[model samples]
Target: MRSLIKIYRATADRVTGRNLDKAAARKQLRILEEIEFVCIGAVAFGLFLEMPSLCSAASLVAFGVLGEFVIHRFHVRASKREQNLSDKESNEQLAAIAEVNLKAETERLKRVEIEERRAPRRLSMEQFNIIESRLRAFAPVEIGVIPTAKGDAEPLEFAADLCVLFRKIGWLPAFATRIDHTIRLGLWVELSPNADRLAQRAAPELVVALRIAGIAVDQDVSRPAGGEFGGTGEEKERACGAGIILNVGLHPVTARGY
Candidate 1:
């Protein structure tokens, strides 16, 4: 009996391998054990009823096959149930993360409002009019300003000024501040993969414009993680969708430029 148990365990290990789903495999093994017992009982009962050896063997085989079919159906259903439960849990986690992000956004907005009230207006109406006049030749585009840290008002202020300038030139501009620790230096203008040709062409010009406005700006093109251009220690930023992602970094006095 011990030798048989050892053989069974060896066979199970060989069949399942190292990467097999243990829970599902164990459930299937249990079902197989139950089927083995049922087959044995059916064979014994058939023999006790004076059935021929051939008839008993056929009955055992039929019972085993039927048991396997039923157990297989149950196994499939069980796997699907587990998968659904996993998906539900994952979705709930995602929703929770989104809620947290929303709350953080709300807080950032409040800070921005406070900052706007406290920080004296830097650009006069006449200077803004001149920027608007210069931007008249270029078509309008939506711009997003993302700050790298909370309460870092320099980037937010720069974005705000750009927003005012762009709005004056009939462009849509929005800003969102986030607490990202990766960004260290000059402001980054990230363009989306499917960004319009006009936007792509205007991106460099916008960078130049920001520099001329005394704000240090650079184009940020992040490579895919684990790719040839990606560094081992670098955290890849998520891609912006169909527009521009402006990453606001720290002021020069706070951190050195990269």
Candidate 2:
């Protein structure tokens, strides 16, 4: 049994080596064929369509045939060389396989190795939200805050992260985010690519929420001409400039608004 196991391992290694050699040979041949096909196709198409003079056409055809001959000759030599190499490698694998006994054990170990590999991505949205909340809380916030909302089309995980981030900082109140974009009372905020238009584009529901929170939109916050967001610093000042600002230091937590 022991001897058989040793032989099996040896065979497996040889087989893997031969397979790699075969793949390399096939790749080289494909590259050569592709180059030949493109060059030949282009020359043939041009000769048939554009060359009007018979002497020019004849010379082109003759030169093309000569090129083809050289290419084919090279291919034949390369093919023969690869075939010999492949056969030799395959024989080695076969010899090892014949001398081996524990193919099942080897196969089992290979499967185990693959199974141990880590998955592509780690954190779920809910989990990421928690982390973002923590990070945001630590992030500095001034009178003005960047109110970011992932579009409705964004992935659930991404949305959760954004919300979590918003909650952590002074940007949003605790659990301030909701899955629904509209209020049950028939109020909703408008979704737009441009945040500057929020005052105009935001639905009645969103404006009401901001108003309720004491975040009155400053009409006097003149829009900057050269840039967008209307000088966010000024906007923050406006928010702070209000008679009173709420949730200035409070953590974002969820609460229902009618």
Per-residue error at 245 for model 2, in Å?
99
User: Model 1: per-residue lDDT, tens digit, 65-141?
Assistant: 67667766666655554454444445555555666676788899999999876664354565566556655566566
**Residue 105: error of model 2 in Å?**
19
Question: What value of lDDT does candidate 1 attain over all alpha carbons?
Answer: 0.52
Q: In candidate 1, which residue pairs clash?
A: none
Model 2 residue runs over 4 Å out of place are 1-21, 101-258
Off by over 4 Å in 1: 1-134, 219-258
TM-score of 1: 0.36
lDDT of each: 0.52, 0.41
Candidate 1 local lDDT, residue 25 = 52
lDDT of residue 255 for candidate 1: 22
